[model samples]
Target: MRLNTQIQGQGFPIICLHGHPGSSQCMSVFTHHLSQQYLTLAPDLRGYGKSYTRQRFEMKEHLQDLETFFKEFNIDECLILGWSLGGILALELALKFPEKVKGLILIASAARPRGNHPPISIFDYVYTGLAGLINWIFPSWRWNIETLGKRSLFRYLIQQHTKITYHYLAQDAVPAFLQTSGFATDALNQALRLGYNRLENLSQIHCPCLVLAGECDRHITAISSQETSDNLPNSQFYYYSNTAHLFPWEIPQTVLNDIDYWLTQHPEIFQSN
Candidate 1:
């Protein structure tokens, strides 16, 4: 698959993968900063952005495509940062290509495949359903400049400078979430049907992993990040106190700082592990 990609900066490779409903553009915030120190490449995964392909959406296919894409760039090894669904894919890639993956930074991701059923909460269903309906009706009005500006002064400044439209939320954002959720649900069902717990094989991943969770993330709770950290011998966990599921977007500086510190502490591990 010809994945839509944006390459920037210069130095060691750092591939940024966005989650479902998010395109490479989502990583624009980090690329401008990270690119100064590393060669950052952010790609829109299949079925989400400009990647043109009609194949069935599956995790394996995504992994294979990324492997191929990296190889084509002669990227034998590099750091990887993935958010949400992208984080799950990054984990699978680290397992499948251990030698090629130097370090991993996962944001709001879980090791175990998520359950299909949403928790018993009418509000959850109602809110999500309403969001879906609004998305379908007006797929270009998900983010309102005034609203976001009021929510976070930092985000408002970014918006003012970038002028990123609310269309991202209405059109690409909501539909992307719905699609990935459905796909993950199906993958979970298939794993159960095959009598295999997908996460049972996580022990094979030995790379130095850093799992970051948002304290207020309702989708992937901090408990889930703790569970994932416990399963990996070489993993560390951190939680952003005032962040939500969109921690990376909300606190890019903090995430970058953590990653820089991690690289400093694990220089040898990235080079030789």
Candidate 2:
């Protein structure tokens, strides 16, 4: 399938992958800045945004789709930067195709199930439990048919998933949420069940890897990210204060600068080995 992608600038290629249940639009905050410095391409994963659709997808499928996506775009190798679920895929890619991946930049990513974001609101408490039950009792396809396809209803649900107050949401986040919502709920359900841990193989990853997170990130706590860094054979970890899960969006300039410095330190990574 021809995944719809947004490409800008013209330099070393850097592909940005968004989180589960999110489309490439969510990466716009970072892509907008990175595009000026690198040849950036952001695509809506299958079943989300303008990409091909399916009833469900697991982590492996996402990785495979991305492999094909790179080939179609004539990208043999380049930097792989992923946020949240996207970061998991980036790790898998590096493991599976070490020769094709030059380096990795993982943001708000972990190797195991994420702990609950703290200060859980009363709404999140109830909603989280409800979502868990829904995943267990129902198939992802059924939920996508019944609820995921409805844009308006999905938007409301998006607001509830965040730990942040809505005081700034409608103005700060909802627009992208609305545009990025047409994804299969099954993909997200599979992710929650993914428990996508590659602890044993973390040391197997030899490519230069950088993992970043927000100290205040509720989605995937900084503690887990630190562990991921600790296991990596060649890696570095950094966290920002008062930040949350959405690092690329929450602190675009910092992410941009950090990535730039890391890449600069290893100019050889620019070559696909």
What is the TM-score of each predicted model, taking all chains together?
0.73, 0.77
Total backbone collisions, model 2: 0
Please list all clashing residue pairs in model 2, or write none if there are none.
Answer: none
Predict model 2's lDDT versus the native. Answer: 0.69
Candidate 2: stretches off by over 4 Å:
52-54, 118-176, 179-183
Expressed as tens digits, the lDDT of each residue in 10-71 for candidate 1 is: 88888989875577777776677789888999987876666645445655677778988887
In model 1, residue pairs whose N, Cα or C atoms come closer than 3 Å (at least 3 residues apart or on different chains), thus clashing, are 139-170, 139-171
Which lDDT tens digits does candidate 2 get at residues 63-144? 7788889789888778888888788888888888887778899988987746664354566545544443443344233453
For each of the candidates, the C-alpha root-mean-square deviation to the true structure, in angstroms, is 6.2, 8.7
Q: Rate the local accuracy (lDDT) of all candidates.
A: 0.67, 0.69
lDDT of 1 at 158: 23
